[model samples]
Target chain A: MTADDPVRDSLERFIGKPMGEGAVAPEEVNLPMIRHWVDALDDRNPIYLDEAVAAETRMGGVVAPPAMLQTWTMPSPVIAGIAERGGAPTAMKSENVVTALDAAGYVGTLATNSELEFERYLRVGDRLKTTSALESISPRKRTGLGLGYFVTWITTYWAGEDEIVGRQLFRIFKFDPSTMGGAA
Target chain B: MSAGTIHVGDELPVFELPVTSTVIVAGAIASRDFMPAHHDSEYARGQGAPDMFMNILTTNGYVSKFITDWAGPEAMVKKIAIRLGGPAIPGQPLRFSGQVIAAEDKNDERVFEVTIRAANDLGDHATGTVVVSLPLEPSS
Candidate 1:
């Protein structure tokens, strides 16, 4: 059996569970911040650049680009087991397959697929509450060509009075490049 | 935005990084993320940019570590969101940093509001908000 195979609970338990939630505190977003994200992606979507142009569209005031929220970081205090509590890890027991591969000494990995869903446009001042859940964890299967592993996490983002976004799902594969990709 | 762990308008320790592709890939491996946009410059540039771009998850890692590093590992990152403004190209210098804006205590959690950005020569490429839970320091 491949090391990617599930050993304990399904890999689903190892990642993507909700940590907690917070609020936007009303009218909190500053337009400049929105512009910063837009400029970074180099996306020429005019609605984001010009407010009048943005108003012409359904979303008002240069709404945040769908993928923007995913790029930001969460409030994680560096010290462990001191200031806070770990209710449940976004990760599960079986989800360790990927980490396990590295632990067991597997060398390389490859990415296979990803899916993201945007339920509503993220507004500037809207209060956002993010809730997450572990989606799935599949055992790493050894293919005739090589070996790889896969896992997914589901996050639901909510804004004040609206369900703004849903599901940022990610997946990956691991293999010895020397055997498959022919690399050192 | 808060007097907790940070004051309003303080530039953080630039999420302390070279923002390298290795860091990006480490995040992908941790999450088992496989998106052509993250790993392949060819696929990434085919869509846009001069080369492959860092994944949002990797960006999040730096961002997460940035604050957590300050708050200490024990702190919990309740929620975070980033808006991708520019691409974090591989082999270039980038900064992951932010400032505290507000603080609240709810359900025994010391909630902090922070505005963070990943800045580079290209200007700020990413910006977002963070909500963290931290331990309280005993009054002297």
Candidate 2:
């Protein structure tokens, strides 16, 4: 897709736009959620579960995994319901770009890459907030999946007021999966 | 795990994850990723995916868990950068492995950079780097 493409034009309007007004986590960093995550992954880390072990360590207390940064700020189901019910404005999200592309015949999407940088580990009780901005939208390119464009966004996770705990550079491809048959 | 003992070529411990459909769906929900492609097998197949695949959020959690499992709980992750190449499909076990590429002494702590990869039969599912800081041992 090029600048001349209507779908591309719609997506271009989102470039540099912040995702949502500012996403504040509905819950604070806590052990229950962290436990759920570790359990799901079957992670047997003593510091994450055993308080005594954590006390002996330098961290002095249990801390949420840095990778959980995005989890804390994920859009809650209630919030999604509100948006679906038209009770709230559509938050600035990359999904909007996908919806626009889907309407233009690009119905398939897949995450291609992600880069995360964490400044520090998040401790229990800490709250998180996130803001994302569309970084770039690539021109149409051929790939194993099909003809598509790559959309990139930068999301920063914040703790408390101003401290940036982590940042994720995420990219996904919007494409026509049917074209895969012709790809090598 | 002492940071001082790590070397540039040292290999991180390998981990195997037995992926299951239930786990895939549960992980998606836990991560608040309600994407149909991650839970509904039919929806995934419709999208040309073999079956419901692991979402990036779940992949990120697994990657971090693998690193911390080797680095020990005391070690704090400073960064992780990953690129997804293949779909982590259910019924295929995902194997995770890594090697220490660099280690440095920063202030009173030791930091190690590990190059890591997660793979399945299809090929590398994800590859990335993680920077972790190991606490300094108390002076005796």
Candidate 3:
């Protein structure tokens, strides 16, 4: 697809716009969630759990796993009939780029890349809020699965109203499965 | 290891993760991702996946553990950038491997960039770089 393609033109308007109102984590950074992750992943990193051991290190105290930055702001799941909802933790909004792509017949989704940057280790009591903005959308291209467009977005994690703690760039390919193996 | 001791081309010890349904589900719930593909095998198969697979958040969690286990507690991760490929499904053992590709000193810290790859029989699950830093002087 070219830049002039109506679908592409429509998506272009979303670039640099906030995906939604954004979200605030329902809970602050706390030990229970940290410990659950530590056990689940078997991370065994002392700084993540052992206060005494963590205190002796340069970190000076316990810290949440750096990778958990994204986990903190994940929406709480409404378990009832989640599978019926196609695994969406909650109801999805209707006007975002994702919904737009679905409406445009590009329904298949595959994550392609992730880039996470952390400004500092999150300590207990730090509450995080997230604001995600659409970054870019590639012109449609043919792939093994089908014809697709790559959509990229950046989510900024804030510790408070002003302090940015981390950021993540997430990209995914949205394709039309029906177009698989059609004309190149 | 201390920042002073790190060098480019250094290889971190290999860490292996035994992927299983429990592992996948645990990581998903812990990460607050309710994606059925990470838990319900039937739903995943219905969606054309071979089986339930690990989520990205779980993959990043393991990746962080793999790096910090080698770099130790003093090392604070600055960045983790990875290209996602293939499914991390049950019974496939994902082997974690990495090598320090670049090292530099800036102000009071030494930063190192490490190239990492996590793979299983199906293929490479993730491949990319992680940036971590350590204080030039140990705090204690």
Candidate 4:
């Protein structure tokens, strides 16, 4: 398919009615769980590893940070080189999105920022579910690469009770990387 | 805007979610936010961010839903404004805080004027104000 394909066609079948959500079981909030995440981010914050300091804080323990949801839900690297699984290659974080674009039948694109909201906490061991939907899909004035963009509403739930923990609204653009600043 | 609906000091829903590298990496990859600070810690530090910073936009979405998610599905989000401060480092507990400061009825819709904030063990990370429309129809 050429770079000039319609962006609406560049999405995966998952884009239909396209409401998505996931539920994860609750787990105990522990130090090890907290430490690994901090270590992964290379954070030296004493709260993650230092119990003494943790007791002094309002949390009463080495509780995870407020925006710690990212530490818990990341993609596995097991499927490293499936072009069809993800399009942009291993190096590009935008790979699967790029892949989704290809599945949608469009090429060369970028993910644009819009807005987000933080609502709850996810301590270690807190099982949760995340759900998302196609909030809106409107045509932008044709840019250099594709015709328009698609935006979605992604939300995560903590444990079983809370209605929401966080929300993310993002947009993806389908275009020709070669024609623009282009290419990772 | 009516002050009775939401007092000036009422807090919005700002979540104190965990900040972890796994979610950082996964979320970064999922959103295709390829910034190094997100994927590589050593490189991220070298670049001057405090470990992996949660993508700001994603942070906003997460917190926004903390409120609207409960408010309902038909509630239309009119607008949201955010200011990012410290890097949302992994490990730190992030508190997503939002409060309704004002409210008004326009064209048959109850428009909530709210202020949102995200704080960590250290201090505030992000803050913003939002205007959202609640469903005219009552919840089931």
Q: Point to the candidate with the largest TM-score.
A: 3
Residue-level lDDT of model 4, residues A1-184, one tens digit each, is 2255355444433343334324343344456655544454444544456767655543345545444554344333333443333322233433344345555545644445444454534455665556655555544335555444554545444555766666656565655434444432
Report backbone clashes per prediction: 40, 0, 0, 58
In TM-score terms, candidate 1 sits at 0.43
Q: Which structure is stronger by TM-score: 1 or 4?
A: 4
Model 1: lDDT of residue A178: 39
The TM-score of candidate 2 is 0.87
Worst 10 residues of 2 chain A by lDDT: A83-92
The candidate scoring highest on lDDT is 3
Q: Give each candidate's interface RMSD in Å.
A: 17.6, 4.3, 0.8, 11.7
Q: Chain B alone: TM-score in each candidate?
A: 0.81, 0.94, 0.99, 0.83
Mind giving the per-residue lDDT tens digits that candidate 4 earns over B1-140? Answer: 22234455676544457878876776555443455656667766654456867765356446545655434433445556565566678899788777777777776567787777778876777777777665343332
Worst 10 residues of 4 chain B by lDDT: B1-10
The sequence of per-residue lDDT tens digits that candidate 1 reaches over residues A1-184 is 3443454244445555542343233234446655655444333455445777666443445665444454332333233332122212232244245565555545454434434455554656655655655566566456533655544545565665666554555555555433653322
Per-residue lDDT over A40-68 for candidate 3, one digit per residue giving the tens place of the 0 to 100 score = 99999899889999999988899999999
Sorted into a CAPRI-style docking class, model 2 comes out as medium
| Model 4 stretches astray by more than 4 angstroms | A1-30, A40-46, A80-84, A87-101, A114-116, A144-146, A161-163, A176-184, B1-140
lDDT of 2 by residue, A64-127 (tens): 7677788888766544454233222234354566667777777777778899888877888889
When sorted by DockQ, best at the front, the candidate numbers are 3, 2, 4, 1
User: Which prediction has more favorable TM-score, 1 or 2?
Assistant: 2
TM-score of each: 0.43, 0.87, 0.98, 0.46
TM-score of chain B of 4: 0.83
